[model samples]
Target: MQTAQTVMMVRPAAFRANPETMKSNHFQKSWDGDLDVASLARKAFDDYAASLRAEGVEVRIIDDISSQETPDSLFPNNWIVMLADGSIFTFPMEAHNRRRERRMDIIADLSHDYEVLRRVDLSRYEDKNLYLEGTGSLILDHDNRIAYACRSSRSSEVVGREFERLSGYRIHWFDARDRLHHPIYHTNVMMSIGTRFAIVCLESLSSESERRELISQLERTGKNLIDVTFAQMEAFSCNVLELRN
Candidate 1:
């Protein structure tokens, strides 16, 4: 899919470390019950939005309602996704609070610029404990119609197949583990795919066959693979995202 020149962000109102999500999310730290998390989160949110605007990118910031208390609202890309053909997808979130992050008003606002042909509601799968947290669960190689994913607590083959059937993307999945041998929570946290470049933590893929498949696919797709070690992936090197200017 073509990258959007415009991006959407949520201004957090009750942002804090989520207890339920912290188990799978390695980047999240448990708050020691002392810091002014809300205020700090707001400042960071504002600064990040300002930086994006400085780069000549249009950012649509939607204020998160306090009633929702969605701690991960800032990561809107997890609940909602927009396809190149104007298909809007609402995914099921692993955490209950994260599910509240999905807002129909945002879709209404986005429709002003993008043609929303239809909505694919995969939230029903959550009832079965089959979670697929939007772009967080699957990284799309849109041009090649491939959905790259690493199965974990928040993502699964059941929902991955659903995504493939609905979005018309082929699923390419492998098991990825952290240095501690724990499953990586989200696929986006371990790999990123771009038009001409791919950054991945090959060490995370324990199976050599899976690692080779990932490399072979990247090479076949004409992407320059930038391999990173487990330590580098911990530094957020594999968590790269591309934006259109």
Candidate 2:
């Protein structure tokens, strides 16, 4: 169960660069050219879904609430994670507005198709200011039962430990920084783990030891490591997802 055959996506209703997330997510920028950003986003989403469906992938598309003002709701993966074992985990988001992206109705919709044995809600940690934004903060190697996460505002060690305890997956924690020396907001932005391969930006690791350890672990687990440069990482070369068709 390293990869999923079915995936969920949210159609943007108010698709614009979120100011609340921009502070931590350096990759995001405000829309300068106004050609109807929401319209363009919708078209892109439709094309992406169509392409995935053409590839024999099951894509569940959900529409965002227009009045919610949750611009980043398009990324549903950050708030909720569904495991192959019928376990659902809800994460605590760092961005205030992003927190609203989590909807019980979506979970209910999913329950109609999938058997949800248990749900672990980690949003209570948000009261303590500890956040771990689902797959955004952690890159999971489900087949190997290993989780990789980089230290960042959105990814906290305390919450990571809790995730490890709840999910029964060992986590390898590391520090990663962008080219500008700022902590990489999300681990997914710097690395991705597939069934037999890993795409990572080794240059993003702040510590040499951490970089070596990550490489060693990936190699030990029989993963073909494809290293990318900082520039390529910034271009989202590492932010990739592998799905089973």
Candidate 3:
């Protein structure tokens, strides 16, 4: 089967225009420009999502509840993935604010179209003091049975392996770090996989061995590598959604 034509985008509760996210070299910053951050964020969110819809995607737009003070609420994929098979896996987030982002009502809302095949609840990991943000942790090549992940508080071996066990994917695990030697919080920040290609910043992987491993996984899966520099990755360039067309 092919990928879904649906693209899900959460409206930005904390909308603002930030230059930092436009390029990868710097830490993506919060909006401090003349425009009201919230307003700009809302416009950007709408425009990007509208662009996707224009491409014939079946987009589901959910309004963000801003009063709750959830800054990163716009990135919905961190919380859920509505599989074509109808299974919904709600992720356990490392950040407290994100926990509110998942509402069963949202899943219930989606049940009308998608079949709920499986529910893999890892939120208990939060009590155990571990985490793994859904697609943020794992870049899955759905058709190829491959999953690429970088270990972080939101991406742990225990949870990642558990997902593999349920999804039956081959895991290619590695440590990804930034220029300062700190681990990248999300694998999606450094790379993304499309049906035919990948956009990645290979240098972000601290170890030569891990870099090799990442490249090997991509190559073995027959993905055309569209390599980006660490400069590009930080721009959230790797945080892409390959929607159903």
Candidate 4:
């Protein structure tokens, strides 16, 4: 689906800066010692969901269970993705605690609104320490059947190939890094695909060849590439998602 009228958001119970994910996630800010980070996160989540609901968007708010200890539970996009064909694919997460964020009950609840044709489980890759963080790992151009991914420890060629084999999406893989030359954790944080436009941090791509190839592919797929700088990427400008009302 190029645009979705409905979205599911998890209201975090124990939301805080996750130490396990901090090494890879440069975008996450460390919680200050004086502030109640969990409380702040909960308030932000509630307000965000409320704002979406007020905008006439159908927001499915699921409360995260405190006992789960999943600090990044609010980011449901990392664990599960639903395709237009009604296939719900579950992915393997690099962080063990993040893996616990996946809830079968939530998938069951989605059946009330969506026609789930099949459930594809790719979590088996976790046993081999190979992971693909769902939509976060892949910036998919649904109209073109192209899956653009920035190769990272959390997202590798092995699982990317498997995703292509299962979803029939051709993988356009590239190596992207931050200004510090550290690998970008998730593709979604620096690339986004919409029907008419693509937000991408071409500067983050390490190679000129890869940048040229990505631009060529995006143009061929009829997307106007809105190239962003590394600084803008760090500010989360490329992390935009499209929603249709």
Candidate 5:
């Protein structure tokens, strides 16, 4: 029933400033070696917006808070999720660079029209070395009240479990691996679930039991499967969101 009429995406200001992943984290950037980040990001911004528009979705394009120099602002799901009930969640991110992306000004701008409810600020957990990077760490099955997550430093089992308890979502979990044979950092970068369909790269799941569970859950929920290869996943195929459509 979510016809996702309006969606938002941030134009990447510092395309190559994702220093957390490049410097601190284990995740590798595919185009880091020889890519003109600003140029590539601009094209990607256009293309991403076009793709969403092609689906008849209205896009709310916001240039990232460049003055703040917040990298990874291109992926906005971390900082906010405007809910059907008009509530907004301000999530906590594990990466220090990402944590800086949250700004009250953006939230305040959004509150002009939407009914503002409680702000669930989870940043306190970060002080304890616990974190949950919003939709990046948890792909919400909003209709079913489920949150599918892969345990990582960004998405701790403890945190995901607590979210299940708080949000009343059943946790569909798995331990997945990337090409380098390391666990993928964020869950949303690997798989996405929707009401009518599911787009996933089953090959990324190295364990048979884990893969089976992920597939079975989708199938049981009556979803049409669109399986992609790990190559496609690397292309951000898993990053595709089935908006309110």
Candidate 6:
């Protein structure tokens, strides 16, 4: 399936901006005041899960371990991805602390409902300084068997190729930059691929050739392209996921 009928979410016990991720993830911002960020985050998470459940979407909530000190545990997609083929792939994270977010118990929990055929652990590449932060680095076009990725420290070409070989998906690798000309930390930050539609910031691509190729492929695969400006992309217009109800 291109989209999932069920989704999993992590409820944070100590939600705060991660200092390690702040180096490359420009979208993250540190709080200025003594706000109870964790409380606010919990409230938002509950509201989001409630809304999804109201829409008939099966939402699985996992409480984050308070003693783990994993500030970014809320984003489970960055560490592990469950594929339609009953395979789970664990990716290497750019931030050292984020690696701690991976837990076998979560996989075991998911296996109760879903048939997990196999587990692929690519985290070993971290020892070589190569990283691929799961769905963050890849915007997968499952219908077309394509994996779109932007080259960044968090998304290495070596790992992308490895994923391509393992997952049997064609990798369309490209370079994408923010308005400040720095490489976009994640592919999902500037583009998203739905079943029959795609939201993309074409201007973020480094070269016009890459943009043309991307557009051509999307069109070929019957995607209705929705191009967003740099401002809209920075506002997270492209950071969206379409799930089956």
Candidate 1 segments whose C-alpha is farther than 4 A from its true place = none
Compose the digit string of candidate 2's lDDT tens values, residues 1-245: 78889889999999898888888888888868858999999999999999999999999999999888899898898999998788999999988988989999999988888899999999999999999999999899998899999988899999999999999999999999998998999999999998899999999887889999999999999999999999899889999999989
TM-score of each: 0.95, 0.98, 0.89, 0.96, 0.87, 0.98
Name the lDDT value of residue 82 in candidate 1: 88
lDDT of 1 by residue, 13-107 (tens): 98888987988887778778778989998998899989989998888899999998888898888889888978999998889988888898888
Clash totals in order: 1, 0, 11, 0, 2, 0
Every candidate's lDDT: 0.88, 0.92, 0.76, 0.90, 0.76, 0.92
Worst 10 residues of 6 by lDDT: 107-116
Candidate achieving higher lDDT, 1 or 2: 2
| Ten residues in sequence with the least summed lDDT for candidate 5 | 23-32
Ranking by TM-score: 2, 6, 4, 1, 3, 5
Q: Can you write out model 5's per-residue Cα lDDT over 1-245, one digit (the tens) per residue? A: 42367888888887675656653245555464776877787898899889888978888877776777776888888767766655577776777778878878778778875688756666777788897778888877777767788877777777666666655668888987777777788887788876688888788889999999888888887878889887898888888766643
Clashing residue pairs for model 5: 2-244, 4-244
Error of 5 at 18 (Å): 2.1
**Model 6 TM-score relative to the real fold:** 0.98
- Winner on lDDT (1 vs 5): 1
Candidate 3: residue 72 lDDT (0-100): 71
Which whole-number lDDT from 0 to 100 does residue 175 have in model 6? 92
Model 2 CA deviation exceeding 4 Å by range: none
lDDT for each residue of candidate 6 in 91-158, tens digit (9 for 90 to 100): 99988888989998998888887898989999999999999999999998887789999999999899
Which candidate do you rate higher for lDDT, 5 or 6? 6
C-alpha RMSD for every candidate: 1.4, 0.8, 3.5, 1.2, 2.5, 0.9
Clashing pairs in 4: none
Clashing pairs in 2: none
Error of 4 at 35 (Å): 1.5
